[model samples]
Each structure stands twice: as structure tokens, then as C-alpha cells.
Target: MSSPGPRRRGVSVPRPGRGWWVPAWAVLLAVVLLGPALAPGLVLSYDMVWVPDLTLRSDFLGLGSSLPRAVPSDAVVSVLDEVVAGWVLQKLVLLLPLVGGALGVVRPLRDLPLPARLVAVSLFVWNPFVAERLVMGHWPVLVGYGVLPWVLLLGRRWRVERRLPAALPVLVVAGSLSASAGVVTAVALVASVGLGSRTRAAVAVGLVAAANAPWVVSGLLHAAAGRSDPAGAAAFALSGEGSLPAPLAALSLGGIWNSEVVPHSRTGILAWVSLLVLLGLALAGGRRWWSRGRRDAATLAICWGVGLGLALLTWASPDAVAWVAAHVPGGGLLRDGSRQLALCVPLVASLAAVGTTRVLEWMEDAGAVMVAAALVVLPVLLLPDAALGVDGRLRAVDFPRDYADARAAIDEDAGPGDVLLLPLASYRQPAWNAGRKVLDPTGRYQSRDFVTSDALVVSGTVIAGEDPRVAEVARALDLPTPDERADALVRAGIGVVITDLEAPGEPPEVAGEPLLRGSRLEVSALDGARSPAPPTGWLWAMAAAWAAFVVPPVGVAAAAVVRRRRRRDTP
Candidate 1:
């Protein structure tokens, strides 16, 4: 072969095979991304709650609950609690997905030099949308966001290579853990299946359906029982803040409705800058891809178009959105259409990476380095505390000592029966948690299975499971006569009544003698004890579906490991 042509002047040469470094970069990126959470003290606020020495339950597949979203993180928390503090586990729960997200973004861009790749990864992980969601305490959704890129990557691989990537099942399982993320992945997989072979598409569809069986089955089972919240759809409609263009802000990923979660300053300017930069870079990358005829360019372009279109439809076409939400079962689950922007994040990151690499191709190595440095540093300047703790440190809140003791006492005396929480409410702002907003902890803290009237009230309407027993208990608490209250409690099958002494309003004094007393809570036993509702047929179906989805993948992974070990030993 003739001598290679002279290297082009001022063109930065690509590094030789930096694929191995992707994982290392991902780990480092995670550490940087989670810097605020890694602070010395626990950072708890907005939906993050960890009680010291509390027992964690593994009943994630139980029917009529969305708690399955936290199952993976809860498992990690349980393990991490064995060595480090529980709060550390909570931080890791947030950090791990981010690391996964970064890795997913970086893996496809391994052809680029490390610096440009890092810039792209940072751009994806440290945007205003991510910051707002983090501050809003949507960690599970964040986890899904992190897992999404990998799902797309593996899906593409399966289609192009005509063989299942070893990681597909794992990513499917991980993505399905988050309810919203699971839906997004399913949608993406369905949409992208046309790119692959028929076999590959069928396999992808099957795995996605199986992975989502838990929530899918649960949702289908309770479809008739639950109602839609139209107001919730209206409140969480996708739109920009004051004076900002909705489409531009959405593409920039900064249209969070909650002012509390958004940065006080720089939001408007940052949105404009981000939109312009991303759009310019994407256009440049599109031109490059068009010239080269790259399939990825088309794939990413489709995703971006679809994501932006959905977001716009939700923001600009409220009637269309409302119609979809009403007609489609569980479509109300996506009441926050802003979440659909998650689909655009990876595509934008990829295009940004391509644009960075293209720009670097025109510069000398040193100039490329300088530009890359600026790209990496840009996010920090625009969103200073994006990666750090949102709002403030999350100090660990302990349950009242007496509350724990009372739970113990109730466990000893009260047989198997459901506990009723008072004053009846769907949500709670506990004094112990420094008044942080959280779902009522009665079901989590009580010794026995607990029932609360707090249905998931979406936009002032009960959109999920509603127990008339919860209503009966609420009425019982309102009764002035102790005997009438006691009768009502018995009828509702509330064997044990636990009242939050600190709750606003006077505590109910039932006729029954108090069985356990504490400073924060008091428990009294009903004379005619009632048992908890038995597990429904749908629950069994859900459990079976989860088992089928989880077990086979685990077995396949194990077999693959065993085969590798066998080959290594033979060699």
C-alpha cells in the first residue's frame, strides 16, 4: 500500500479506539453529576424520604399501587444500607441512573474523541429540564430518562445486527421499572421497530410488553374502577413560562410548570441560548449526516421530530390532548406532557456530539481541546446547581421514638387487620420530615396492613383506586359520639385506628380502650376486628407476569456468565 496521505493541516486526528474509556468516563461523569448529593450530609427534599432502621417491603408487584416505580431504588437502598448510610443509598439511586444515562449517550459516540464526547454527555445530563425534574423529586422518572438512551441503542443494534444484544433484556427490565419511563420506552420501541428485521421487531415488542406487564396488567385490571382527571391534564399541560416561546423552550427542555423547581434567574436567557445552540448544532449535524447518508441521523431526526411534535400538540392543541386523554385508557398518566420531551434528550445529545466532532475536525488539537473545554463548562455556567443538591441538604428524618414503640406494641397485640390512618388524607407534610411534601406514610410505617382514604387525587378528582371504606372511616372520624365512631370503624373493617396527634384538628376519641399510646400517634383496637381485603385475581396475574418477565432474563444472564467462565477455564 502506498504511504498514507499527509494528515490534513489544522484537523484534529481522532483518537485510536477510545471505546474502552467510555465506561470510565461514565463513572467519572456520574461522580461529577451527583456532586451535590455526595455532600457530607444527606440531601432530602421533595419526595425523598428515608427513615432510619425502617423495614423495607418487597411487595412491589402488589395490585392497585404505583409504588413499584421505586422497587429498584428501594432494593439498592436496602443493600447500600448494609454498608453505608441509607441516605447514601438514596443518593446512589439518583446517581446510578445518571451514570447509566451518560454511558448510554457516550457509547454510540465512541468514535469521537473523549473531549467532544464528554461535552455531549454533559449537555444531555445537565440540562434545565433535568434540573427542574430533579428539584421536583421525580427521581423514578429521572431513572427512566437515564435508561432510555440505552434502550434506543440496543434496539438499534438488534435491528441492524439481526442479533439480540446481551444488554437488551437488562435495559428493558430497568426501563420498565419506572412507570412513565416504561411507557416512553414501549412507545419508542414500537415506533422504531420498522427499522429492524421482522424477527427483531417481534422480539423487541415481546420483551417490552413482558417487561411492562406489572403496570400494564395492573392498569388494565383497574381500568373500569379508576376515573380520569381532566383538570390534572390541564394543569400539567406542556407550555413555556412567561414571555418564553413554548416550542423553543420545550426543545431547550425548560418548560417545567412548578416555579419552585425552576431556577429563579437565567431561565429565559438559558432557554434561548440552549435552543439556539442545540438547533444550530442539530442542523449542522443533519447536513453532515445527509452528506454521509447515515441511518442514525434519520433515526435521531425522527425521534426529535416526534418528541417536539407531541410536546407542541400538548401545549398548543389542548382540545386534541384532552380528547386523547379521555379516549385512551391510562393516557391521563401522561398528564404532564412536558415529560414527553425526554424522547428528545438523547437525540439532541447525539446531534450535539456529532456537531462538536465536526467543529473539532476544522481545528488543531489544541483549539479543539479549548472548544471542548468550553462546551463542558457551558452547562455549569448556565445551570450552576443542576447537579448538586436541589434546593438544599436532605437531612435524614427519624420517626418519633414513641411511634416506633407504638407500632411494636400494636404488632404484639393487634392480629392481622388493616390500620386506618387519621385525619383522613391522601398526602401528608410530616413535621418529622421538616414539613416536606410526601404521600402519607401510614401504609409504610404501621405494623399491620394499613388503609387510608387518600386516593391519588389528580386535579381535585379521584382518578385512581377509591375505597368507600376510606370514606366510611373519614365519616367515622367526624362523628361526635364515640360509639357511632366505633361502629363506623367496625363496619369499615378498620381493626386498628392510628391517629396523627400532630395532624390539624382534634384527634378522634373512639369508644374502644387505647391499645398503644405515643406522643405522635395513638392506636385503638376495634371490638369487631375486620381482616384486610384478600389479594385479587388480578394481583396473582400481575405476580405471575412479573415472575415470567424477571426469571427468564436472570436465567439467560446467568447462563451467559457460566458459558464465559467455562470458556475461560478451558483456555
Candidate 2:
């Protein structure tokens, strides 16, 4: 028998330098197309009220004020001027991963093709939660969650390129600085490195430091506040074991993709085809990994280890529990573990992309199947509660149209700091309707999103669930009527009155200057308060901030443009 000749190992064909541009362009195109649909404030369900509730205006940016009570630290607020800046910071966090993916896809990485790179970028830049974050303004979480994947990808590149010494520390520092989300991401990145032995010790150190950094910082911050709690919140892993049904648990994973807040305008027959394609890719990737041997196994293992480890930490969340016990001194500050799952989704998406690529290589003919799966099954499997909600106070719907009209009618008649004696719950309504800052707003206790629960109502009322005053108020706010309540507003020196027109009883009697009447709201005022000067210092600060975010990136784009133009002209 003749000895078998050496078998050829399958190798990925490398492309030229110019090809890298394609991935960047493709991602940019996708983002631009999806911009209008995903960029608005429509996707945010609960945080909508909170962001604006915290909105304060200072002379700094002329952007207006911020909520004094929203942040835990005066130090953080002192450095940051506007609530909008804070909101932007949060949006940046969410966008960071997409930025990283774009970098990896477009930058001069070795041994990757334009298409392969673009797919990697799309796996994250196209994430649904990212779009939601842009609206909601969970800056710390978004920032932390978004930066990790790029760190991991960079770690992988450093190993392949023999630049571990320099890249490792950079990765560690970047990972540690992002706060809680960063810590979790750093842990995941190290876990990925450990799956392969090349930079195991360095990776291990980075992971350990990443995991512990928040606890250290949070601890110090809390200690400065002069308080500590030794016990923490119960671990969700154990506590939620029975509370969540299997279906709901699955939904939690998928529900983040679609929300009750946003309209689903893209749904059509194309959906079915997308589902099939994603499914085909997953199946194909799985088969390829199993047959490819140890190197592929190790790579997949690293990805899985990092992703799964973060998931488990979030599941257990002893750190979070302990932080809560210590009253969020250093570590417990980022109370929810669910935020870490944001990073996990992208990691899983990357795996999905890898799987799709492998399937394409193996079957060569089943690309259509992958697209179908993405369109149909994935959406079905992930999101079941796609129904849009109607506006109601009880259901937590702040009617936008009614609120806007009411606010307009009232603002025309009111001045700065003049009390608008609408229903107490009217303050809880949307800003466009409320006309002035509300004395109280409706929020949840132990909230999953915003932390204004205690402040939303006057306590005990929510626990008893039977404040007759609250019930009566809710009924009255639903309709503006001439009752004893209207007489009380004039007595209380309320300058303007805004209401929803249809009240259970007669409209409230107004004593102040009558401005105008809409179908929903009434406006009047006793006096107009002096409008304060804009905070010139704050505007300069905001100008600095806008510069901070926009200038560097624009410079890079300008350089790229010049380079491309020069290249074209050279020919």
C-alpha cells in the first residue's frame, strides 16, 4: 500500500490592503440606513420620563438643566454639566461596541477578507438593544458593555501578531476603566485568553483586575459617603429560579430585541426568509467546528468561556449583592446584572456570524437558509411580546399627543418657577403636557430601569394600593372638572392650570390671569418669574464636551478622505 501524501489543510485566503475599506463602508451604510428608524426616543419605555425628569438647564451648554437627584455623587454631577450630556455619555457606551466592530472590520487586521470582517461588524452594530440604549440613556452600562468585544478582538490580534506585551496592558486598562460593564467584559476577555495558553498569565491578571476594579472604586466612593451595609440583595440566579417561567426566561433573552414601546414597521414576508438564513448558518457553523479539530476547538472554546463566564457572574452576582449590602460603596453601584448580558448578546452574535461563515464554506449553497432564519425564526424565538401599548396612567403610558397639547396651552400663560396647579399626577405626565416640572412623578419601586420609585409617590400610598385620594386624583386628572380641587389651586397661588379637558366633575376654578384653553388643558398665571441668565460657564463646558466627542473622529475621517482622494488622484 502506498503511503498517503500529506493532506492539505484548509486555509483562509488573505485579501489585499484596500479590501479592508469595504467592511467599514458596509457597516457605515447599514448604520445610516437604520439611523432614522432606531435613533429616536421612541424605543425607550420606562426611562423616557426619567431622562427628562433629570433634565436641568445651566448656563454651561444652553442645553438646559439636569436632575440634581439622578446621580449618586455630586462629584460626578459637578464634572458633568447637562442631563443631555449624561444621556449622550450613556448612548456612547452602547455605541462603543459597534464602534469597535467597525474598527476591527475596517482597520488593517491581518488574514481577514472584506466580507468576513463586515459580517463581524454587522453582528454587533445591528444589535437591537443598541438602538434602545440610544433612546434610554443608561450611559454607564452602555459604555461598559459596548467596549468589551473590541478588547477581546484586540487581545486575539495581539496574540496572533506577537505583540502581547504592549496590547495586554492596554486591553486591561481599557477594560477596567469602563466601570461595571468594563469589569465584566475584561473578565470575559481574560477567560477567552485562558482558553489558549499563549498569554495565559497576562490574561489572567487582566481578568482578575477587571473583576475587582469596580469593587475597589465603588468601595472607596461609598466609604467617602460615610455609610456601609454588610448584607446585599439576593442573587437573581437563585431568587428568580421559580419566578420566571421557562418561556419568559427565554423571552428575557429575546425581549430586549423588540419592545412594547416602538412600532414594528419593517415586518413583512422578508422576515421569514431572514429566519431561515440565520438557522442554516447556525447549523452549518456547528457542524464545521466539530469536524475542524483542536485549533478551531480552542478558538470557539475561548469565545464560549468568556461569554459564559460573564453570564454566570451576572447570574450569581455576589459582587452586586455585596455592593448592595455595603450600600453600593464601591461595587454594588451598578445594581443590575442584566446589563452584562448586553456584551453576551454580541459575543453570541459573533459566534452566530462565525457559524454562518462556516456553513457557507461547507454547504456553499445554503446561504439563503441563513437569511431566512434571521428573518423568521430568530425574531419569533426571541420576541413574543411585540404588541404596542396604548397610553394610560396605570399601564405606565404617558400620552404624548395629549401631553404636548396641554403643555403648549399652559406654557403660553406661565413664567419661570410659577406653580402650575394641574392634578398632582399631572406632574407625572409627559413634559409636553405638564408645562412645568412636576412636584411628583409616577415611578416603580426596585425599578428595572430608572431609580425614582421612592420619589414618584409619597410612599405608603403605593404599598397600601388603596389611596382613595390617588384613585380620585387619577380619575380627576383623566378629566378636568370644576370642583373643590380647582378652588384649592387658586388658594394655593397656582399661576397656571393645565388639564386633560375631560374630568369626572366640573373644571377647576382659576383665579390667575387666564391665558388660553385647549381641548385638554387650561392656562393661567398670577405672575411671571424672571428667567435666569444662561450659565456661560456651563455652555463653555458643553462646547468642550461636544468638541471632545466630535473633533477627533472628524479629524480621522478627514484624514481618511484625504488619503483616499490622493490615492485616486495618483492613478
lDDT of 1 by residue, 355-413 (tens): 77676666787887787678766755666656445434334455667666767767777
Number of clashes found in candidate 2: 56
In candidate 2 the C-alpha lDDT for residue 66 amounts to: 17
TM-scores of the candidates in the order shown: 0.85, 0.47
Query: Candidate 2 — worst ten consecutive residues by lDDT sum?
Result: 444-453
Task: Give the top-scoring candidate (lDDT).
Answer: 1
Scored by TM-score, the top model is 1
- Give the clashing residue pairs of candidate 1, or none: 42-394, 43-394, 44-394, 426-454
Q: Across residues 255-308, which tens digit of lDDT does each residue of candidate 2 receive?
A: 222133222322333233334444555665554434443442454455445544
Q: How close is candidate 2 to the true structure, as a TM-score?
A: 0.47
After superposition, which runs of candidate 2 have C-alpha atoms over 4 Å from their true positions?
Answer: 1-96, 105-117, 128-136, 157-178, 192-215, 218-280, 287-335, 362-429, 433-571
lDDT of 1 at 255: 77
* Full-model lDDT for every candidate: 0.65, 0.39
